[model samples]
Target: MQQKLIYILFIFASVISYGQVNLFMESDKAEYNGKDIVNLTIILELNGVDLEPQTRFQLPDLSKFTIIGSGSVTNTLIDPATNTLVTQKVSRIALEPKKKGKIKIGSVLVTVNNKIYKTEPFDVNIKDVVEKRSLATNISSEMYLNMEIEDREVYQDQPTVAVLRVYSKNMDNFRKVKDVRLPRQDNINVHPISFTKSEIDPSGAGNMASQIVAVFMVFPNEAGYVDVPSVSASVSSYSNKNKIVSNRVKLNVKKLPEGSPEYFKNAVGNFSVNVYNASKDKIEVEKPINVIIKVSGEGNLPDMYLPKIVSSPDYEVFSPKITSKVAPGTTGMKGEIFANYVVIPKKAGPISIQTEPFAFFDPASREYVDLGQKTLALNAFSHDQILESRTTVEKVNEYTNTLLETVNTPVLKTTTFKVKEKSKFHWNILLTNIAILIGLFIVYLLFKTWQKKRALVRETTSPKPLGSVAETEREIRETLKTDINDYFSYLENLKDNGDYEKFFDTLEEMDLEVRKQYLQSSSDDFRIRLESDKGSSVAEEYRNLSQRIQMEKYSPLKSAEGMEELLKAVVNLYSRISK
Candidate 1:
C-alpha cells in the first residue's frame, strides 16, 4: 500500500511540471569603449513544456543604438528523454550607448504543438562607454565612367569603327542625366551605332550598378594627331544626392595609301575577277551571247565599283545586272559578286572581249592588291537562220488591199443538200485541268513530308531531365562516408531546384520533432553549422530553431524515433508547394 502511494505522488509531480513554463531572468548585458564599439547578449530556458516547435521570441528594438557591431549566439541540448530544452544567444554592437538607464528587456513567446508559451521580462542596465582613437570609415562604392578605342592609326578619309563603354555599380538606383559630352578632335567625323544599355545585377561581375555601351563609325578628313574630348554626365543616387563625371581619349591619322587605283575609292581587302562565255563555238547573227563576269574573295565590295567591260564599237551591248551575297567575319566582311551581260552578234567573225584589272587596299596585309584582266572569245554568224524580211513594200500593200476587198464582198454560193454539222467535245481543256490538279496534289504531299521531318528534328533536339530533388537528397543521405564537399554539393543542387515556397516548407519541417532529433543526435556539425553560422540567413519561420541552438547550451525537445516520419512529411509538403 505504501509503494502504491509513492507511485501516485510521482505521477502528480510530473503532471504539474509539464503544465508550467520557465522564464529565465536578465541573462545578458554589455558595455562599449568607443562610439563604434558595442556589446550585448540574451539567454532563455524552458522546462517541462508542451508548445509548438516553430515559435519565435520577440525582443525590444534598438533603433537608438548607432553604428552596427558584430554579434554571436549558442545553444545546448539537455535530456532528450524528458523533452527539456535550453537556449543562449549573444550579440555585440559597434556603438556607444546613447544614455545610461535601466532598460526593460522584452518578453519571449514560443509554441509547441498548438499551445503558446511565454517568458517573463528582464531588466538591462546600460552604462557610459569609454573613448577610443581608431574609428574612421568610408564607402568606396562610387559611380564613374571609362572609354576605349579599336584602332588609332588610319589614312585620311578612310573608315574606322570606334567603341566607347560606360560602367557603374549603382545605375539602377541612379536618376537624371546631365552634361554628357565626347572628346573633340579635328578633321574627324563620327556617327552613332545601336546597342542596349542596362543595370548590372548580382550575376554580373564587380560592384557595377549599371553600364552603357556605345559604338560609332569614324572617318578622318586630314592626316594629323586628334584628341577625343572628355565626356561629362550626372546621375542621382538616392532621394536628393546627385553626381557628375567626365572621360577622354586620343587618336592618330596618316595620309591616304599611295598608288591607289581610280576605281579603288578607299575600298579595302582582296578580290579575284573571272569571265566565262555562254557558247564556246559559232553563234547565229543577232543571237544573244552572255559575258559572265564573277568577282570572288574577301573585301568591302559595296564601296568598290565593277570595272567597265570594253569591246568593239560595232557590237550591241546590253546593260549589266550585278548580284551579291555578303557574310560577316571576325577580320571583316567577306562575300562574292556576279555581273551578267548580254552581247548581240554584229560582224560575222571571231569577237574578242576583255575585262580590265581592278585594285583595292588589303587592310589585313596593309598593302594594295589587284585582280588581273580576263578575256573571252565569241564566233558571229554571217547569214544563217536569222534574216530580215524579203517581201517588197509595194507587193505587201497590194496583198493587204486584196484581203480587205474580199472581206467587203461576201461569197454567195448555195448548196442543195448538206449533212447536219456535229460539234466535237473539247478534251484539251479537261486534260489541262487534270494536269493542274495533279501538280497541286504533288506539292501538298511534299509539304507534309517536310513538316514531318521538322517535327522529328525538334523531338531529337529537346532537353532531357537529369533527376529530382528527393532523389538527390536520398543519394546524399546514402553517402555518409563521402567527403563533406560532395554532401554540400548535393544540398546546394537540392536548394537551387526547389522554388521559394518549397524551400520554406522544407525549412519548417526541418525544425520538427523527427528532424530536430536527427540533427541533435548527429556527431557531425554539417546541419548544426548551417543553422547557427554567422553567414546563414535564417528564414523567419525557422528563426526559433536558430534562437534555441545559438544559445549557451544546446537543448532539443524532439525524440530520435520520430525523425523519419517528420522528414517524409517535409518532403511531401515541399513537393506540393513546388507544384
Candidate 2:
C-alpha cells in the first residue's frame, strides 16, 4: 500500500511539471567579464496555457548596467502541428561598470492566466577599466540629409522632387524618425515621397551592423524659382538611446520660358508638336475642319493642357476635346495628350494662327526650356463661292383642284365576308401557341441588345476599366495569387476594366478607422508627400500597384502573403492621398 502511494505521488508530480511554464535566459554565459556589454534575451515556453495577443512581459534589470533601449514586442506564429507557443523579449543596453565587483542581473517575471513565472538571475564581473576597442557606428553617424538640388537655381511653379536618404554604414532597429520644413512655393507645387524603411542584411564579407538603404522620391512642381530649403531628419538608436538630427538640402527653381505654343500650357519635358488639317484642297468657309495637335515626349502628360485660339468675328470656335494617355514612373510622367479642335472661317486668304512658345522649367537641368511652335497654312471659302457651288434649288408652284370632289363627299364604306364554322378546340390552341412564340421572340431580342451594349462599352474603354469600385477591388484581390509577371498582367486587366472615378471611389471607401491609425507624425509627413504639387507619389504608387494587381488578376490566392505587405503600404499611401 505504501508503494502504491509513492507511485501515485510521482505521477502527480510529472503532470504538474509538464503543465508549468518554462523560462530561459539566453547569453554567451551566465557571467560576463569586466565592462563587457552583452545582449540579454529572455525566452518563454508556455505549455497548456492560452497566451493572449499584446501581452506584456518584463525583463531582468541589471544593477551594474543601465537599460538603454527596449524593442517593440514581436510575436512568432505557432505551428498547429507542434501545438506549442514560444515568445522572446530582448532588451539592449550599453554597460559601464560602477566598480570592480560581482554584479547580479535580476530575474524576469511573466504573468499568464494569473499565474506568475520567474527566471533565474545571472551575474557579471566588473574588473579594472581596460581600453576597449571602438564599437561600430551605423550609417546615420557620418551621412546626413542634404538637398539634392540647389535652393536658388530652380524656377517658381516648376516641379521638383528632393531626394532625402540616410547613407549609413551600420544601422539597426531604426525607429521614431521625423522630418519637416518643406513649404509650398508661390505658383509652384511640390510633392514629396517617403519610401518604406528597410534594412540591408549584412553580407558574409562585411563586419558591420547594417548596410545602407535609400529613401528618396521625385517631385514635379510648376515653373518660377521657388525656394526648397534644407530639411531635417531625426533618428534614434536602440543601444545608447541617443537621438540624432540631419541637415537640410536646397534647390534653385526658374520660371517656365515664354513664347510657348498655343497648345503648350502645363507642358513638361522635351516634346515635339505637330499640327495637321483634315484636307488642304477640299475646304469650305463655315464647314467643319479637323485640327489635330499631337504632342508626345517624356514628362507629366496629365498636367498638359492646350492653349486657347483667339478668333475674329468672321470665325466661330469651340473648346478642344482632349484625350490623354500617360504612364508614370520613377523618372517622371511620360505620355501624350491629344487635343482636337473644329474651326469655321468666314473668308479665305492667310488667317494668322500664332505659334505660341511653350515654356517649362526642367528640374533635372535647373533651367527653363521652351519648345518653338510651327504655324499651319489655313484656307477659307467665301459665301459667294459657296452659293455658286450649289447644284439644285427647289421650285414652288400654286394650283387649284377642279370640281372632281364636290363638297361633303359621302362616307366611304367597306365590305365584310362570313366564314364557315370550325372546331373551337383547334382554333383556341393555335392562338395560344402564337402568343407564346411572340413572348419568346421579344425576350430574345432584348437579351441580344443588352449584350451588345455591354460589349460596346467594354470596347470603348479598352485599355482600362471604368467600372464600379467594388468590382475593381474584387478584381485586384483576385490577382494577388498571380506570378510577378502575371501580377502586372492582371493589373493591366483591372485597369482596363476600371475607370478614374471608380479608382478614387475605392480609396474613399477604405475603412476610415484604418486611416486614423496612420495619422501619426510619420503619416502626416507622408500626407505632405502625396499632396505636393511638384510631385505625385500617389500616382506613381498607383501605377506600381496596377502592375502588381495585374500580376495576379485570376490567382489572387497565391499571392496573398506578398500582397498583404503591398496592401499595408498601399493603405498607408491611400490614406495620405485621400487626405
Candidate 3:
C-alpha cells in the first residue's frame, strides 16, 4: 500500500511540470492594405520554471515581410495556487509588406530549456489600396501616411507600441521636411524607439512600396479614455506643396486593481531585485566596502521606488552612488539600475547588511510579488586581522570610489597651536645654520672642478646643434623611457575593472603616440616613411610589430600575456631605431 501511494504522488508531480509552459504568437488583424505595416507579438509563459531563463524567438519565414522595428519585454510573477514564480516574455516585431496578396505567417519557433516549440500558422489578406484623386486639381499624387499600434486598450502603466509608416507609389521623395510630427498629450509619457531600415522592395512601375519610419512607446499614467493625435508631415513638391497625415488612435486604459498596498511601488512590469556585497564577506574596520542594491530586467526602472539601506551600529553608511544605463525599447526603458553604498566597519563581528522588503504588482498575473528584504551576511574584521589578498584595495569595494580615496581629504587638528609667548635663542639652532653655509661652500667648489673636466671632454667631441635630428632623437627617446611607466599603470587600472573593450582602444592610441615621436612622422603610412628614413631591416621589424599589435587588439580573447608581449615589442623597436 505504501509503494502504491508513492507512485501516485510521483505521477501527479510529472503532470504539473508538463503543463507549466505555454507559447503564443498573434498578429494585429486578419486583413491589411497592400502598403500597410503588420505587427506581430510573441508571448512565452513559464508557470514554474526559472524566473530568468535563456530564451530565443526566431521567425523562420523572411520572404513574406520585411522587418522594420523590433523590441521585447520580460517579466516574472508569483502564482498563488502552487506558491511558485511565473515568468512571461513578450516580443513585438513590425514588418512591411513585400507584396500584396494572401500571405501565410508560418509557424514561429521558440526555444526554451533547449526544447523547441512552434506557434500555429495564420494567413493575412492584403487588398489593393485605392488612391484619392482630386477632381478640382490636375496635379496627380500617390502619397500618404499610416500609423499601426499594438493594442487599442491597455491597463494603466501597461506599455504599447505605436509605429509610423510612409507609403508612396508615384510621388518623389519629400524635399524640405525637417521633422516628423507626433501628438503631445497629458497623463501619458511618450518614449521614442529607434530602429534601422532593412532591405526592402523599392518603388517601381506597377509596384506598391512602404517603409516604417518611426516608432513611439506609450505609457498611460491614469485610467479612462486617451486620444493619440494623428502624426503629420509637410514637404515641398514641384507643382503643389503636399501635406500627409496618419489616422488617429484611441486607447482604453483601465484603473489598477484594488487591494494594492499603499507601499506598493507604482512599478508595472517584470523585474528582479538583488542586494549583495561588491567584494568579499570579510570587511576591515576603517576601510570601505560596497553594498549594492540592483534591479534589472524590464519595465519602468527609472521611476521605480528602490528600498533604502538601513543604518546600523555595526557599520557607518555613506551616501550612495547611483548609475543607470537605460535605453528606450518596446517598453518605456529596459536596462540595469544600480545604487551602491560605501560603508566602513565600526567594530569587528558578524553583522547583517539589509534593506526593507520590496513589493510590486504584476498586471498580467494580477498578483503582487514581494521580493522580500535583501539581506547580505558579512563578517567585519578589525584592521589588523584583514586578509592579505584584499589589502591593496583602497577604493570603495564596488564600481564607484568613496570619499576616503579623494586626493584632497579633510584633516582635523588634534590640538590648537599658538605663537610662543616669549622668544628664546638656542645654541644648537645657531650652530646648525653655520654648518649648513660651510657645507654649501664646499659643494660649490667640487662642482666647479667637475664642470672644468666635462668642458675639456666636450672639446674633443663634436657637438650637435639644438635643432639637429640627432639631438631631437636623443630627447625623444629619453622622454619615452620616463613616461612608459605612467602609461602602463593607466592600462593596468582599466584591466582591473574588467573593461577589456576600452583597454584595447587606449593601448592602440598609446602605440600610435610612441610611433609618432620615435619615427618623427605624422603621416598615416608609417611603414613607408619609416622604410625611407631607416633601412629595410628596421622598417621590417616595425611592420612585424605593427601587425602583432593589430591582431592582439582585435582578437576575441585578450590576456595579460598579450598586452605585455605587445608593449615589449614596441619598446624593443625603439631600441632598434636608436641603434
Each prediction's TM-score versus the true structure: 0.32, 0.33, 0.42
List pairs with backbone clashes in candidate 3: none
- Across residues 1-579, which tens digit of lDDT does each residue of candidate 1 receive? 999999999989877665544433344344322222334443444444343246555445655544333334555565566665544333333333555556554655556556665556655556654321111122124455555555656655455665544444545433333323444455655544322233444443465554554444455656655555544444532344343443444445666568776556545557778888756644766778777888776544544567657766647778898887644333333477778888887777777787766776776677777665677776676654323423455554665477556654232112211222448655664566466556766787898899999999998996766689877666555543233333234434545563333433444444342333223443234345434542333322133233322220111122232333333444443232221
Whole-model lDDT per candidate: 0.50, 0.49, 0.67
**Stretches > 4 Å off in candidate 1:** 1-147, 156-159, 164-251, 257-265, 277-292, 340-342, 380-579
> Candidate 3 lDDT, tens digit per residue, 51-146?
234557778585866565566998887777676777888998777666777988888777666677889988888775433211113222465566
Model 2 residue 191 CA deviation in Å: 4.3
For all candidates, the clash counts are 32, 87, 0
> Once superposed on the true structure, which residue ranges of model 3 sit more than 4 Å away at CA?
1-144, 169-171, 174-186, 198-209, 229-248, 280-282, 325-333, 384-579
Clashes of 1: 32
For residue 226, what is the lDDT in candidate 2?
Answer: 30
Query: What TM-score would you give candidate 1 relative to the actual structure?
Result: 0.32
**RMSD to native for every prediction?**
39.3, 32.6, 19.3
RMSD of 2: 32.6
